[model samples]
Target: MNAERFEALAEAFGGDVARWPADEREAAAVLMAARADWARSVLGLAGEVDTALYAYAPPQASVGLADRIAAAGPRPGRGRWMGFLWPAGLGAGLAAACAAGIFVGAHLSAAAVSAEPLEPVTMAVSDQDFDFDLDGEV
Candidate 1:
């Protein structure tokens, strides 16, 4: 490994060769063997940061923290009906729209009938359709 790569690995893995990636450990070892002094300097800097992080202690939460967080959560009744009614409301709205369309169609048909005069319907008969002779007998 190059000096730059060795320094980068030391910084990322907290100067611990064991913490370095398994594939990179061999290359890092080779680099350290070639440049012991330079590698130690980089590792020393990274080790200081690691030591500070390991020494840190976070503040503990109070006993009522969970209860307070739970109290801040959504109430049971909020949006409860929406889960059950969303699809049902969509179906009801579609049904209303269909009913409205049918009502408008019927109203339009009735208006058209009253506003225009009706015409007589006639049909033409072909000779092939009726070939029976009329001999004045039933």
Candidate 2:
């Protein structure tokens, strides 16, 4: 039943008591009855503001606005996969590398088979070769 609460309700909901919040409307009405003059002054100003807002006219959009917006949008086309092939030049490069590897491998293997066998070197091992002092301790 506060005057400030009554003023706020009247301003927001307009001069109609029914339009005010159901729970608060009764208390606000009591305040309005107790201070009719103040409540009327606040509600009168609120009504004036509401009237001016209602009287305003909104501007219309320009002609062909819908057409322009529609035209600017994306057009339907083939699926995403149709756009481009992935790793475009990698296939050709890979084929060329494989061919070069086969050629080199064949050439190396043929040369190895045709080359002269290395002569086996004969050496004598003795106990003196293993007589050095080891650096690590057990």
Highest lDDT among the candidates is held by which one? Answer: 1
Q: Which portions of model 1 show Cα errors greater than 4 Å? A: 58-138
Q: For model 1, how does the per-residue alpha-carbon lDDT over 41-136 read when each residue is reduced to its tens digit?
A: 898899999999988988889899989999866666658565565557858866888999999999999998999877787677754555556874
What digit string (tens of lDDT, one per residue) describes model 2 on residues 13-81? 887777778999778778878888888888888788778887998987799998999975555672343
* TM-score for predicted model 1 compared with the true structure: 0.42
What clash count does candidate 1 reach?
Answer: 0
Q: Candidate 1 has which clashing residue pairs, if any?
A: none
Tell me the lDDT of candidate 1: 0.83
The lDDT values for all models are 0.83, 0.75
